[model samples]
Target: MTPLSRTCRRLQDSLNSFSNTFIFIFTTSHVRTSLTPTSSTPNSLLNAALITTYPPLKLQNRKPFEAQIDDSLEQPKPIEETAFDALKPTRLPSNVPLYSMGSSSSPSHTIPVVSTFANPFETSNSIDASSSIRKPISLWPGMYHSPVTNALWEARSSTFERLLDPPLDAPPQSELLTKTPLQSRTSVLYNFSTDYILREQYRDPWNEFRIGKLLEDLDALAGTISVKHCTDDDNMTRPVLLVTASVDKMVLKKPIRVDIDLKIVGAVIWVGRSSIEIQIEVTQSTEESSDTSDEIALTANFTFVARDYKTGKSAPVNRISPETDKEKLLWEEADERNKHRKRKRECKREVENGKVDDRLEALLAEGRVFCDMPTLANRDSILSRDTRLENSLICQPQQRNIHGRIFGGWLMNRAFELAFSTAYAFAGAVPYFLEVDHVDFLRPVDVGGFLRLKSSVLYTELENPQKPLINIEVVAHIMRPELRSSEVSNTFYFTFTIRPEAMKDGLKIRNVVPATEEEALHILERMDA
Candidate 1:
């Protein structure tokens, strides 16, 4: 054999051995491996490409890449927390019976067993034995109690529960047949000056107190006062059930500031056999002084009706006796209001029956004249339709009260917001809340129902050149599309005015005129109110 032939054989053998080693290492390891030319390998393989292999990368307990990307994109934004969130019940009581509208009668139910005066702000560990034994806090003649929880919302619910289950140990009906107005008098103080957290709850964006919140508290307070008058004992375990029927008027006499302390005093001014008339006054301490001499900021009147808890029939309430001259005057005023309400109801029924009174007929005539002649003098008069605004939403369970009905306060807040918007749009300036003339809850709203609020500038008073008053009416309806039914749930009347500062640019507010006879009648009704 030749020497050159032997060397060629040796080179071929070396190349074959190197290739086998590279393949073995690549297949055996679970990680990436690369085979490059080394000093022991042939020089011809130095410039050749390197052999490399990589195993598939795996992550423990992870979603697919596409799924991860989708999840990141679909994540919801965080919601902001508000002070009112605490007012919501953490969980509903399992024992409370749910009322069904379709049912012939309410199912027999019992009140849940719980503390009568549990302080929601205190935890179990913080509540001492002495505190638990303390006398029930009395707001007035009849102290309010809650079964499930002690939140203000629950306190309101206690009154509703009484409508279904009255206390069995109530006093005899003949014992406390009469109650003085002073006996039902009560006052609640909201010390915003020291309680920063409470102030935030009632404060608006402009640092002023929210009148909508005030309206809610006022309704609750009035209901409490009514219960106080009807029940003779402080325990409030009476066989009478009282609920708010209507709010006659709520007038804002002055602007309310959130920085100062506020006080609400209310009493049962008068009572019928089954109805109660309450007067609530809101006052605020003067910012300049530390004394208790507060000035009146607002006044409201509410009417409530009582019913027998078990029979669900009209129940008589204790008669209110007037002692002081002030009390006598209030009683007289309430009597007049009651008479006026009856007359108004009759007039409404007559109009609904297509019988228009002479006053309403005259107003309709004026509306026709305004519509027929749109001359230069009356050019600023716009039709009510042109000054209208509306919004709608589905009522949610979160908006429900303890009785499973939509809360009255929630309705008032929504109506006021829509009215404010209507006034702002009509005036071409930011409108300031002046007063809530009247609110009527004709029917209760249900959860999951479609609610629509329609607001319009009912009329305008340009008596003052600097500031013009805009009267807005908001009508809320529960629309059931499936049933092809739309029912009016509430009617709200609010008055707003453009501040002099907002009208400094010489913006003139156009007068609102009714376009139809119905609208004309509504205008006249408000005028009378």
Candidate 2:
């Protein structure tokens, strides 16, 4: 349990660290709010508290929000004699102009003539005199809010708000006009606290999930990531994947979330007993083969795993940060080789604007091992750069088959010789024949013609660690010396797995790289390709 907790914390720490990175920045304002995550697995974000001060409003050099009743008392109203409807002020009733007349009754009672400014007899729309009433203060809600003050002080505050220059809020305006940097800041903060969760939390769904559907996982579909925790036989229960991250460190307060992509090629699943032997007519809608260009199907075996998926609480999974060195190298090599195919010699040539693209240098440098392939006469036409091992031999005349064409064995023997020449060096110790996988003859060979063979190491399994078994890909191509430039007579793959324990104990392992994803998938343990 502690181990899992540790894993969760670690993942959270990583997420937090990555979130702060410029590239992984939080770009939205909504993500910027303060959030407290309680757990790494299914991290729970808590509500945030906001802090703000009441705003002040000013009108006519006076703070309109000032505590007072003068605006209400001063508000003007006409004596309603006729029962007629009137349009009320759109703004708050208090905003209506107010008129102050001498408390004493004016002579206007003598016939009571309405003043032009405050007509007592006028209806709401009769150029009402009350409309002319003026307040010592003015208020604009768009600019400010209620303020605490006396009438005189409020008036002064309102006056101040009116004088506030537009440039005072220029900075906030510019921010909205462009991008709101606050959003990015918030996103980074959130991810910074949540990254660690992805690691172990991802394992639980699979851990609790039952592979109820056959061939479903085979379809390589993404499984449901969210699932309920299940009780185990031991009374322990699974937990959700949650994580947190700090600056550079990821801490998992709960489980971590992790996702991986895996591709399977040439898989053979449905294994069973005699009655279990499942066989079905599989129609491989095959494509027409091209005779002019060499056609070949590539195959591989692969596996996906998380070095550590330990998750729990109190204490979490013990991390192997330093222990990943070897794994890192192995995956790096496998991935790099898997992505690239043999490069054509023509690809190296350039005639752009009479100037070569210097950037090509980077490509060559990355594929340093591949760039120095030996150039043959028809270099760019048919032979591959990696086919050198098989290409060296020029097929010589052999007793022809019944029809007088050379026997295929003669060319096959040449391929064997080419493979043995380089492979024999490592066979000084123990040589284990792991397999002689599917071998195909693309075409027939004629007598007295040159045959080229190329061989490369695809993968090696060091079961004992001290001694390794090598899987060599020996590809042999047959070509005619008479018309070698225009024709390739035959091609085939001869796969051999040999262990080097019998070799000189002191010799170091070199030139042996790990299998590619495409190549490894073909050599998966005991599963024939």
How accurate locally, in lDDT, is each candidate? 0.68, 0.29
Candidate 2 C-alpha error for residue 333, in Å? 38
Model 1, residue 59: C-alpha shift (Å): 15
In terms of TM-score, the best-performing candidate is 1
TM-score of candidate 1 versus the correct structure, residues matched by position: 0.65
lDDT of 2 by residue, 436-459 (tens): 332334445555555556665444
Model 2 poorest 10 in a row by lDDT: 222-231
**Each model's total of backbone clashes:** 0, 102
Off by over 4 Å in 2: 1-397, 426-434, 463-467, 480-508, 514-528
Number of the predicted model whose lDDT against the real structure is largest? 1
TM-scores for every predicted model: 0.65, 0.24
